[model samples]
Target: MDINRVSARNVHQAHYELIVIGSGFGSTFFLDEALKHITGRALVIEWGDYQPWAWQVEAQSNSPIAPESTYKNSGNKPWNTTIALGGGTNCWYAQTPRLHPNDFKTRALYGVGHDWPLGYDDLEPYYCRAEQIMSISGDPDIGKVLPRSQPYPQPPHKGTSVDALMKAAMPDHHFICPTARPRMATANRSACCANARCSQCPVNAKFTAENGFPSLFSHPKVDVCLKSEVRTLEYSGNQISGATIASEGGEYKVFGDVFVLGANAIQSPAILLRSDIDYGQTGRGLHEQVGANVEVFLEGLKSLDGSTITTGYNYYFADGDFRRNRASCLVSFENRWWPFGLRKERGRWDEMLSLSVVVEDLPNPDNRVTIDPQSGQAVVDYRGESSYAKAGIEHVFDNLDKLLAPLPVESINSRIWRPTESHVQGTLRMGIKDDGSVIDQNMLHHRMRNLVVVGTSSFPSCSPAAPSLTAAALSIRAAELLYS
Candidate 1:
């Protein structure tokens, strides 16, 4: 079955059974799962064009942090994201960790944030399914920290010498970080070459939306339209009727029985605000991870060499009584040595090691995304109270020497890499109420019966782990509910 690629001008249908916006994990996962249960016509509207693997690798190699040319960053804080077909997965580091069970009930356990409408157990099976699709690799023992119904799809990637040394030095604190890089050549992706460049795997070794679900595009029931920027949703009496889209050629409307907003945490809320929805919670509860990186020079041990980007992590302090007052911190040992730029100066770039600490940020209603009534652009007024995050950072700094005591460290320097909004979350929070939340457990709008929103935007709170895996699981779960 060939995927019918149609231009926005060629969509002659009066209405589709389902219309999904965005081509990221949220949209792709939902569509992939829905296709298993339903056979009706589905239309996917993507704002960006299809980016081939080789083209993405070459483009990323030239500009590491370059923003997508088609996206506009009108907000006070720039959202570092790609607008291409696979979305951020095109440039993601591929770190895939499940949110701890405690993450779902933070408000009940730690008294910091709101509890999710659902819990970790409800999504564990879906997490396994998502991991299988992404060809995730990790130590099965990671389930000790976060419970899992099944082991990862692949064995853990071989760690670098630096990772082994770190584990030996801090045996009680170190563990392998779960990742979405294929360990062996699979049908859709190649085995990782240990290039330390997982962000843009030159050989298409990293799992992404495009590689994971090639059949989704070509399925007979699916129709994909590229470069169709969705502007606003049309609704009547609490039911979404259609969406107004703008393309290079002109503007038009596409009707659908069910509408899904998967344009990510920022753009999704922006679209809702533009539609003049009265839902007070549409653009509230915005937050993201607060992160810092420390550079350490090992006196004798060799670092870098040839290895995966991130192999080991320190999660001993990820959770505990510390959650009562401050956020938990997850430390990752980064194997990418090129970022240090020490090769030219010392010629001993292998001696440099970078440890990144990420502190989870609680939701703050004041820190949110709003549309500029005048400019008609999304404006994020993010003033995240960092007291909890700062406490977590200070704890990591205080215990840094003790954790790396076995290593002969020449010097240690730390810098706070301010939040880049790369992990944008919690804009369209889910809850049991309509007054304070925009979506429900099924990701359906509290008031709009036929509308569903997927992705991190519906997250009530963030966990120490990366949100992509959790987002994928949630999207799949939402699809199942909608299909039923």
Candidate 2:
């Protein structure tokens, strides 16, 4: 607790064997595994204070700092995030899906982007470990595509009638999406009650860092400081000395043998840029999936039998030869959501289904994160959305009619662009070359081996599925590879 006191009156200087910034999935999972191999003291610096689940539900807010205040955007679209102690874990939908095997070899397979330094097999065991810790709910058959090493902890959540139709038509492509929202009641969490609201789960069913990963903070060798903003890494040449932190009492520097930056894609790169640690396009190539929502009207089917808020994933468009010409998308079947429409025609009010297509984008350096001269906060200039992703959307438009032909006769209806998937990636990609990437496959900084950057910021490519599970898996792998 004395390390948290940042004033001239405090005579003792703060130092630790390990210093970790941010407490999201990347930080928590990495720490969860790293501490197993490490016996030294670790300090976690969190920018925002923790809010209880009840407070979050009543306030209808995840963090005291709204996402809009954290960054200055050049475009109308915004990046959604929770800036509290738990980070985005306080406000995620809990949809967990693994990246397709082909996603790792984009350059080798489709000649679009650089290949990931590592492959699915390297992270498969860690994926199983992360899934077990989260008690993920998923069907075993998904292994047909993802090649899982272990079965999910809980059985899959049931799908809606519409999902059944798609799975029946495309058996290999459609399956229940793995989710952190428990299917069976646990001592710490209740089973998901089809609450329909996921971001701010009204029932507190989703696995949040506060509830799911509480031990990471309470570990005997660990201590956490809230409301402590880390400004930059204090390093000389290739050695990391510590970090400069700004707190209410005063500004001071803290020392550590190792530093792990687990902040989000936007903030992590900003921290690196502020520290003057530019290696391999440090603040460039920032992106996420560009998604579009579609509605389907069925003549005879009645919807709403799904067991969770989001039920199934359609991977038919996620990978294939199409990547040689255009980008691909991952289709998600939205279930039990309120915003999905109802028909006005007599006796046909409940025959509609809502679907969303998430398209992966090729990273563009022109679309980047920079520092605002005045505010010093991150300034996101996102003018260049990949044309490949747009082309993928166009391809979907051309083939959706035929793809949905298996379902009952009705209209394909309208499509609306989603403002943000809230999944910021890239900026500090991992690869074998320091000239093109900031970190290596093990997540060690290309310049400073002691400085490890964990999280989606190290993602080499944008996968259409949510990156939380993958990020967590990568964290576990990084810890075992380095410390074990």
* TM-score versus the correct structure, for each prediction: 0.93, 0.96
> Relative to the true structure, how large is the alpha-carbon lDDT of every model?
0.80, 0.84
Q: Least lDDT summed over 10 consecutive residues: which range in candidate 1? A: 62-71
CA RMSD of all predictions: 2.7, 2.2
Q: Which model scores highest in TM-score?
A: 2
Q: Tens digits of per-residue lDDT for model 1 on 1-484?
A: 1357888877743589999998788888998888888667899998877877777677764223345333344445556666767677777778998888889988888888889999999999999999988989886767777787888889987776776776777666676778888778899888877777776788888888777877788888988888788888989999999998888769888899988899878789989899987485788887888887788887867776534678887786688877989888888887775445464446566777788888888888887778777755677777754698788888888888887776778888656565463787889988886549888999999888898899889899878789999999999999998888
Displacement of residue 237 (Cα, Å) in model 2 is 2.6
Per-residue C-alpha lDDT of model 2 across residues 222-331, encoded as one tens digit per residue = 87877777888888889888887777767767788889998788888888888888888888889998988888888899877788988888878878888977887888
Whole-model alpha-carbon lDDT for candidate 2: 0.84
Candidate 1 overall lDDT versus native: 0.80
